[model samples]
Target: MALRIVSADERLSAAGAKTTMAIFGPSGVGKTSLLKSLPPAETLCIDLEAGMKSVQDWPGDSIPVRTFADALDIGCLVGGVNPSADPSGFFSEAHYQHLRESYPDLVQMIAGKRIIFVDSITDLTRQAMAWAKTRPEAFSDKTGKPDTRGAYGLLAREVIGLLKHLQHAQAKTVIFVGILERVTDEFNRTTWQPQMEGGKAGRELPGIVDQVITMSLFARDGDGWRHEPERGEDRRLVCRAGNPWGLPAKDRSGRLDVTEPPDLGALLSKINATRKG
Candidate 1:
């Protein structure tokens, strides 16, 4: 086949299209609840951290991924079991090829959904690292530890690859839930970042997602410092959509408020409106 050239206008348009979002927050900060509030008919939740306990009453469909195998099952990538049965064997070349081939099926399953939520990526990375540690090639008996560099490298690649696949999938929205972690840089200033493992994934994830939001609480004076809110109460869940107070955030739509209600559906509407204008 001869090579063909196409103009920018011929390329796929991002405006008014599905968004890729990464939302991070402390435990019990309403991250899962906010996602559950989106249109249930068009949403599918992939629960990795048992986060559905709070939103158990939500009407949307949810798939609980207690193990990496469960995640693979959802993608229909569970090929023949490794004879050696090594936990890390799933990442072997043959198995990886199976995953690549079956990935389109997973995308097809999500094609009609407007939102595909993965809650949370932090746990997914943990599972990835744990799987890496089981690989003899990636761990050293002499050191009595996994090869930190190689293990995390594998994790970074696996995570980034899966996210990129979902990002380009037919789903209109893909949301990755994560936990918040505090770190101190050389400047001795404390900052918050997503609790995902591997330094590379931490640095790269924000760039891939259309929005990176940090969930927080908004309380009136004298309110106790509690992360969880009471049911039927008005304690607000705050979403910071941009860089502020050293929190990692970005909003490509340019319509999100510095702090707003933690309702993703409303935010998506605003983004669509802005893009149309």
Candidate 2:
């Protein structure tokens, strides 16, 4: 196969560089409210959790993802198909054609949007698991009984494949907003993670995206501790990895401070800024 080397000129054009990020926070942390901070004209939200009440007044478009099938179709619509995938495999060109036939205007619906927003992966995982339970893989061949382990395996493969497909949408930015959960172990040490049904997707998601941000309410003193907002404190987006607090975050662009204002548009602008001399 002949391959042409990409030019440095193309590399420096940040406008063409696509970004995939996951922003996680606890419930009622205004994760959905971040939608208003993005440019409405260039953003489209895939509302999987029915959590648009917070952004109801925002002048942006969103598609309600009520079922697992809708989620898959939308993913395929936005990400396109994997050309190298097996013809009969999931999310192959054959599946793409089926989606096109079903939703003929899907492309036109999101043609002008530069950013594809997913409201919450926590609920998406629930939907995916629900669908996985009905499939043959979720049943044990020996007993023909339901097997949660098999279901989770299928869920992991489907969700990860779907995420990778979205990551390959190289011309548009993709953002997945998810709920963050706090867990304490035997040592009573608290750790944070994305709240999803299956463990595999949450664990592997950080490596798949360009950025892993934690949107949380923190102390104004930069102490890396959560503070009550009722005390008139502020919330910040934790962008960089390795901090006193165990919030999960990473900045691949290397252009962000440890904490940044909770605004999506400004965050994206900073990430896409070109290097200086």
Candidate 3:
């Protein structure tokens, strides 16, 4: 063991912050629909679970990452996949091993990209459960309780691995989308919850992303419904992140904020427009 040291302080760019976004909300909410309008050429969608083809109406080429390793292949980084009836996009274990073995190469490829999109990180949590099912010893330890060892461990590894990839990306921007599911709570009759709210892996995702958004479709109020100012709205959707929607909303110019349930498209358009001005 001779003397060898590596410098910790490394700065190679004059660019700004890295964008890692998470869109969270209940089912039937317009997470994917909103993001569909985004420039697919710049944003790469890694879809593990989907009902979005018809819903989002994405128009481009698709390269499937059935297993984790498949993601490591730069070829799978294909940009345009015209929407069809086929669903071959997802993450799997076989792909995971391939990714692990070819990690360095994938990291390099991701570094060169702008927006890296994970359709839903929720599938990875399920994948973690599947991964845990393989470990006999860990399974035996928590025989009755929730099995959180194997799959959860692997999920953590995968997420951390991707975050590590983002560090090398100069103009990096990442968006992770997960469906919103309702969970019954002691206080409310049935409250909305991010599908990833439970489990070991669920807890880790929010911290990694820059902002988390929750979108929902609400019933009309007044004669037919309760807990609202008025009624007759087609589908009442509120976008809440830091606080309650709290009145309609104000535009940047001190005007009216038009969109109801905010999605990637609205946000991106605003951001892009602001830059142009």
Candidate 4:
């Protein structure tokens, strides 16, 4: 086969580029409500946590993901198969083709949708771990007993594969929302991390997406801890790397400000406005 070269102009086309983002925030900070900021016609939410009450009035479509199987199916269906992966493995071309035959209606359900929204990764990780526990890898071969290490290892692979599958969708933006947890070390240093069952998925997630955002409530008093708006705090998204606070955030686009208003639609617009005409 001849060496097929794709020109830089073709590769950097604005229409061909899309954003993959991971937004983390503390619970009850209205993370799910960010969906409302996006165009209803272009957005599809994968409600993993069953926490759609926050955006009950948002007139957009959502698919309820109740199990790990549902997550894999939806991800493969929406994102398409990774041909480079093992053909026999899950989320591969074979698995995706089988899902297409099983779920014929999913195509029309997601028609014209450009943004794939996952409500929360925390619940998704839990579901993945629960399913992992049932697999043979989660049991010791000799003792036939439960193996936490094996289960977590499998869980990490499943979650990362699913996320990367979604991120591969062409000309479509994939946004994963996750719960952020505050941690205090022995040295009295406070740090934040994504709230997932296994540490691997959260730790590796930043490398999988173009952006890592931390959504939080900021007050005039310089404390971002209060969850109550009545207490004079407003929601903000930390979009830049190396913020003064120990928040996990990065912007690969090199366009966003240190803090942005909590709006998914606007955030995406800025990220995608890089290519020339």
Candidate 5:
């Protein structure tokens, strides 16, 4: 229960190279396609959906794919997937012990990354739900959002904490990908249309890291010249500064330059130099 420091100075210089983010949007918005654009060095992503295989020429194999249980399976990993009502968080102590016995090397391997991308946080959140189901039949809260002591919430907290810890201790850049959840709009004030929101965990992310980039899309830019483009009017990734589902970027200030061809090595170089400086 000790407080862990997450300063850029404290994090490994390798991991402190770039900002952490959450790329989120409605389905078919090309989230998977865009990640292929990032250079693995400046931005390595942990494949949760395993869709990295679809993209050719991306050295995605550089990033490791792991589940919350995968981390808990190893030692020195205190928090991650736990018991919950959702099927994903439904891990048991036996499963944890099994991971320790079976995949002991998982933590060491994961701890050695520059950028840690948790692709498709939707699945990650579901995994938390799974852990909730495994808790002993005690202190029930069907609300699905358990208190920190409750089963579901506890597991969710652990997973979130473990991720934050990875950022602080390992110095890996963290990117959590998820679908945007829509909530009633209270800010627009102009007709108050329904707005999009991130997953349940997104609500509390501001408390942990330095920055959270939300990759969101509004409307398809007329195929946007599938092959290439000549200007800002033709980018694919809808990126915002703080939260993916927060609001649309006003201009080119905080948007993903998806039009910037998918050159992994180049993007990574930029990220690393920034870290070195």
Candidate 6:
């Protein structure tokens, strides 16, 4: 194979490609509710967490994923209607083959849309971990239990693989919702971060997406409690666009407000405007 080189102009032209954003926060922080505001006609949500109850009143298209197989089948369009293999046995060769075959279809599906959202990457990680535990290869014969180290390694690979697939899809934008996890450092200070099941995925996640936003609650003096992005008198959900208070975040577009209401459409519009300028 010969080395290929691209011109600076070509590279700069591709720099304006669409973005993928990851949003994470504590439960009840309105992560799911934020999706309701996205343009329903242009967005499709894969509800892996089955937490659409928050957006039940919102008119949009969503698919609830019950099992790991169900999630893969929906996202990748493989493994038929009902998979006979145990969900925990996802590491099997057959499952890998199915994943390989379905990737092209997944790319096609994402290419046909402007926005593809996955509700709760944390829950997806949980599903992957659960599957890893059931794999006999990850179990310790001496203890008759799954080996923690082995299981976590498998979980990380599975979660990262799926995330990589979504990241590389042809959709104009991709959004991953996740829960927040509180971690205590050596200084005894607790900081919130994305709740990725395996430590590896949590570390790798921020590098894959163009943005990492944290949805949080804010209190305004005597206003009791309100969302971080609330601008009016009433409390509403909001997002922290860039890194704040040790939270992992990035605003590649550099046009988003540090704290703004959770509106995907507005975010995209601002990015597009910036690109045009």
lDDT of 2 by residue, 17-89 (tens): 6799999988898889998899998899999988899888989889999888788888888888788778986
**In candidate 6, what residue range of length 10 has the lowest lDDT sum?**
76-85
lDDT winner between 3 and 5, please give it.
Answer: 3
lDDT of each: 0.69, 0.87, 0.48, 0.86, 0.47, 0.68
How well does each candidate superpose onto the true structure, as a TM-score? 0.74, 0.94, 0.59, 0.92, 0.56, 0.74
Number of clashes in every candidate structure? 1, 0, 16, 0, 26, 0
Residue-level error in angstroms, candidate 1, position 194: 1.1
Instruction: Return model 4's CA RMSD, one decimal.
Output: 2.8
| Winner by lDDT between candidate 6 and candidate 4 | 4
- Best of the candidates, TM-score: 2
Among these predictions, the greatest lDDT belongs to: 2
Please, what are the lDDT tens digits per residue for candidate 5 over residues 1-277?
4668777655545443545555554454456666565555444455655666556566654433354555434312323334432443324445545555665665455545555666666766565556655655324467644344565555556666555654443444565556654444578442111111223345555455543333333333465423121222233443333332244222222223433233333433444443324
Candidate number with the higher lDDT (1 or 5): 1
| Residues 1-277 of candidate 6: C-alpha lDDT, one tens digit per residue | 3579989766554444457888887776678887777888777788888788878888777777766656655544321212333554543346645665757655455445667788978888888888888877588878887688888988887677666656654435778889877779999998777877878999999888888887776655563443343343432233333344555567776777656666777776676563433
Which window of ten consecutive residues has the lowest lDDT sum in model 5? Answer: 190-199
Window of ten residues with lowest summed lDDT in model 3:
247-256
Instruction: Report the Cα lDDT for candidate 5.
Output: 0.47
| Candidate 6: stretches off by over 4 Å | 1-17, 77-111, 140-145, 185-187, 220-244, 274-277
RMSD in order of candidates: 6.5, 2.0, 9.7, 2.8, 8.3, 6.2
Per-residue lDDT tens digits of candidate 4, residues 1-277?
A: 2579878777777343578999999878889999999999889999999999988999999999899988988888888878777989877879888987888888767657888899888999999999999999999999999999999999999999888888888778889999988889999987888999988998889999999999987765454333333353688898989886668899998889888899888888888775556
Give the lDDT of residue 125 in candidate 4: 96
lDDT of 6 at 270: 72
